[model samples]
Target: MNNDTDTARLRKLDQDHHLHPFTNLSRHSQQGGRIISRAEHIYIYDSDGNKMLDGMSGLWCCNLGYSQTLIKDAIYAQLQALPYYNNFFQCANEPAVELARALVEITPAQFSHVFFTNSGSEANDTNIRLVHRYYNLLGKPKKTLIISRKNAYHGSTIAATSLGGMGAMRKQTQGLDYVHHINQPYWFAEGADELPDEYGIRVARELEQKIDELGEDRVAAFIAEPVQGAGGVIVPPQSYWPEIKRICNERDILLIMDEVICGFGRTGNWFGSQSYNLEPDLMTFAKAVTNGYIPLGGVMVGDRVAEVLLSHSGEFAHGMTYSGHPAACAAGIATLSVLRERNIIKSAADDIAPYFQQRLQTLKDHPIVGEVRGIGMLGAVELVRDKHSRERLAPDAAGAVYCRDRANATGLMVRQSGDTMITAPPLICNHSEIDSLVNMLSKTLDQTAEHFNIR
Candidate 1:
């Protein structure tokens, strides 16, 4: 990292060969980004020797931060012991079996079984197959349409992308025809003139309307994140989930909660569905399940769905080669151990998360900060020129891009989602670390305000 020659060589190599996910390829090749050298605790160092506080928690994973040696050691031990094995042909590894049991224990009472995959995208893809197979077993083959919310992120595979309602992602992926979308509970941007609770109810009923329009008999399931994470950390109103739960109960439809970002203590509970008090028929989880140390994801299939799937005597006819990779499962087991034994979820919920929210709330008075909304450890600050009217500072979300760049230059790793500055800091962050993050963000706000003439 310290060597200029090696740094230049590495940069060139990356610019030439690496095809980064969710990045502008032409821009990256022309102007390469920082090459991260190493990390410890909540900080990452680049080859240029700049140290950055990882405000996004390694893309909303690494909840325990970079120094969780227990997870690393578990992966090493598992690899040394079993090396490689596929959960196929009546085969299963010890870690995979143990991890499945642990997931059932931590998740809600309904989730008695799990179906593993390599990432959340694949897990959601699995959900489609599981739903179809379950309904087909029940003699309801007409149930094929799935309902999601606008601007919500599920994943990026063709089916997952179809499940996701992001127009940008769907534009390129050619989403499935059976998938449908409804309104998101993004009060600040979409809740014009109405109170949040009112908006929540109105939007929640959209599910019922869609089901009726598409014919209730054809509707298969409803999938959504507890909070819209990648579409911007847009938390639903207090009334949203209750209404959603009611609709699902009254109608013959399934519910799938995409907890890829809100799982593993991010939302003050083992899972975000617990925080919101909703029992999803299926729950998709990844990211923090392995503490981002390794790729591991799955669906926590509820008893309602599991019973049908188990009762039928036939191959599911769907599975990944590394459906339950031993090493990844080992990492997940260790991650869950850290969460349960230390009570990290409740601890952070009681102290650090509240302090983090309070610190972020201080930015509300800034010239460019229009709104500050957060829950547990995730938050977003929407930027605007005139707070009352909610006028954007620039077109095409250029203002948020500028603010994120300023944040990075000031040694704080963060991101711009739409027109908001989004953050999902590590749950292990203390009061002092929260202050440092806020101070850096405050400074970035000042720079951004001046840059855009936003007095």
Candidate 2:
């Protein structure tokens, strides 16, 4: 299946049978999608043998890059030893137990327990159950509502999608009535007159206001990503997290940090909560846990919630069949080991991150670039028609879509969220790879500007 004929056959098969997520079915069925046949290090190759830098790290998960023999070998070994097992009915696997312990060790001291799931969606779904169960155990069944920020991306399952604040996601169906949303700390898009710091503070205060309006007793938890990954890497101002912490503390609301994107060293630290100095009561994590080798996600249960849940005598009655699959857990253990032994997270934070961010920042001066913002291995460049006024290039975000396609054609993999072009390169990317990614993106931006007739 290496030649053009085979590639066409595969594309035809996919178009006829596969239903992709977040895709325009009509457009895809007509044009077909590029077939990614192989990946190595920070690059992926199409069926036609075109190599491209993976600027977004395979949807922001392949932090260790594509060819990690350690993780592959671990998965293989686990398959040989204990290929399958169930963590249900008071049973557990060695890999699962060890992986959980490793997670607890690397995360904040408060997180001593873990509840595994197959993906971040399931982890967040577990969060809802756990939060509700905790409140019910404490005889506060009325404390059911969860507060989330608009444009945040938690996951795609029913409950997870409801917990998230994307309006487009909620438009198709009614969300859980218990969940509510507040404005995001997207200063570039939303901060019109106020300073970024002021805007962040104001938006952060919205959580407190919502809690107050809902009568504190009714609000069980407040969830958000440390950095809004799918929401265009909107890094809130320095004043944001502290104020959020204060609000949650003073209001007695559980803080749920969705680290699905920022966990496992994407943000320099093992977790984004650590990067932002946030001490959440519950943290939802996935993606890089196993470096995208296998499906694995879990909640890093903080002592506050863990103690309450543990002290209760009744069973939680919430779990998945693949909650602690042995193979995935083994991959997770191997991934974590590699990250620690190689000091990959630290090196990325101290070395690659600076270079990556510096190169990303250089795009701010481009004629169509309104803003360039990022931290660690994640970043975004906002495209605008009028930089000073922040006028969007297209009302329906078509500009970003066009620019993203251009980037892909130019040999780079990046994501477009609304009008913002985002990238989260693998943590293993070297200076040369980072430069390649940025150069491709720069070319894409220039092409987009010319295409739109921007002077």
Candidate 3:
């Protein structure tokens, strides 16, 4: 994949047959895409040997970066020992059991058990099943309605897609009727006229309003990410989560925190729930669980839900073939071991993340940068034509799209989500690597400003 001949052959095949997710199929077929051949540390190399800092951490995974030999060796060893196995019909793999226990130990005190799945999408889908069953057992079968927020991205499965509040995705599928949405806590994009704290409280109360509108008895759970990751790192104001916590507690709605992007120290704390100081009945996790080395995701079943689940069980009647595949579990165990031994999460929070946020914060003064918002290593920069009024650089997010292209061409890998440029660099990045990423992004911003005539 590194050489021209192989790259060209691969590109043709990919364009001809590969239908990529979240892409314009016809455009991809016509223009093709970059062939990422290899990676090291926080950088990725294309087929042409163009090295770009992985500012998005390989789609917000790869928290420990590409050089975790521990994870690789674990996967290899697991393959040699177990090769493959299914956790079905009274069968349980050693690695799977060990990983489950390890997860319980690290997560919040409420999380005492886990249900494994191959990806976050599946795990979120499982949330629906578990929530429904929990209520069914409690004899409240009507309490199946779930409330989410607009632009919240749960995952891609039909159930997860409906659970997510992204309109573009929901329109493509016949989503579940049980899931409903309220507005997101994106103050800059939606509530600029109001003070941030005021907007936060107002938006937080929308959850209460939504529950009331739908009848509190019918609404079983309210699901949300601690920070809106795929929705452009929309960091809620300081007042948001506390108010949200109040609503869930008072309304008797089970809180489901989608920590797929914010878990395992992406949010400076071990999990977003801890960072926000909220307790969830269930938590969705994946990606960094294995440091993106293998496919493994699961729900951290908090005691609130687990107790009911355990009290009554007659073959839960829901599971995947690869629910607890041993190799993936080995990868997860090794990843957890690396985090514990090195204390990567805490160190990143105290040092790397602060520096990363500081460097990106400098871009707030740029001519076209409307705002810079982030916590831990994840961040977003909104591109604007008029920073005062918060007018976008171009209609339909063309400016950020152009800026993203410039960044990739100039050796930095960042993402464009609507009018905002978003990044979640690996937690393993040192000061120098963080500097490289920010410097590349800074240059990209200058080019974007010049191109857009934003002076």
Candidate 4:
């Protein structure tokens, strides 16, 4: 059979056998699927040869865009030299060590050590273990709970899921406890009446209250994304991060920044912590690290935390077989090189990102829009049933479906997170593409309004 026929058959089989994440299984079975054949720049070509602009940048991971020859060559060379090597005991690879050293240069000045993992989820999971082990080593075995903001997303793994704040993800694990939830610093939803600084301080105070309620000795860390990604692209006010940093420092609680979606130039900086002025004691990184070309993630720990963990146990208790896999490390090195050589991050923020953000803001004038919010390459348009009332558009037939489908029809690929439609074009996107992305979004929003019978 031809390749197209084979792809079609495989898709059919997948419909019958596979269970998709963050999707309605029944709806997926009825709708079938489109097989993406290839990708170049910011566009994905399906098996049917239709090109769609990837406004969400393949789940906000492909920051460098698709088809980077540098990364491809690195993976190929590594595969030829050494396909696999486990980082156990004294055994390790050069690429892993080199990548870690390179990371230390770009990350915040406090991050001194790096631990490798296969994905962002695994990295966050590793963080939990390390945090608990660090406390245990310090003879503070009572510290076990990690505080995370409501609507934050760290990852899908059980421990990572426990640390996440998304309601739907949490519901999947009934009776799962240990992680404490705090109020998100979403000024749009939570700070409707209060001043921005007042709203920010109110949410920041929640962390202190939570620590007091749980007892300072019982709380190990406070983990959050500098800008909540999967939780609807929520960006906190300037007052929030400084207060959070102050609280964590005062409480002696480790501040862990999950930069999975906001890292590596996506937020106009090397890391989100830099953008938001968050001085995290530990950070979980993934997605853009390898530019989604390879499955690789890692955790960077500050000297203090590292010292505690090392003193407690001579050996770390957890690891993945593919941790520091040579091939993935090679891809990461190459991707970082391209990011620097091309100055993609600088160009995106200095030129295209500002233009894109401005265009996105224009949508706020549209009657159907509740709010338009974002930073750098990441943006979200919140659709409300009543813009003045700020009532959330229902998630079922009342929300996401109309906007997402309409955008797809216009050849733009956007993602729906509850009532918010998130857009994160690749950092490599040019001004023309940014214009196209914004224009297409306007069309999609207009069409979505008509579909909802809204004026």
Clashing pairs in 1: none
Best by lDDT: 1
Q: Which stretches of candidate 3 lie over 4 Å from their true place?
A: none
User: Relative to the true structure, how large is the alpha-carbon lDDT of every model?
Assistant: 0.94, 0.92, 0.93, 0.87
Model 4: colliding residue pairs: none
The local distance difference test score of model 1 is: 0.94
**Candidate 1 residue lDDT tens string, 293-350:** 9999999999999999899898989999989999999999999999999899999999
Residue lDDT tens for model 2, 199-251: 88998999888988998889999999999999889999988999998888788
What does candidate 4's lDDT look like per residue over 347-408, in tens digits?
A: 88799888888989999987678999999999989888798898765656356767898889
TM-score for each predicted model, relative to the true structure: 0.99, 0.99, 0.99, 0.96
- Give the Å shift of residue 398 in candidate 1: 0.1
The residue pairs found clashing in candidate 3 are: none
Ranking by lDDT: 1, 3, 2, 4
TM-score of 3: 0.99
RMSD of each: 0.7, 0.9, 0.8, 1.7
Point out the higher-scoring one by lDDT: 1 or 2. Answer: 1
lDDT agreement of model 4 with the native: 0.87
Residue-by-residue lDDT tens digits, candidate 3, 105-172: 99988988999999999999999999999999999999999999999999999999999988899889
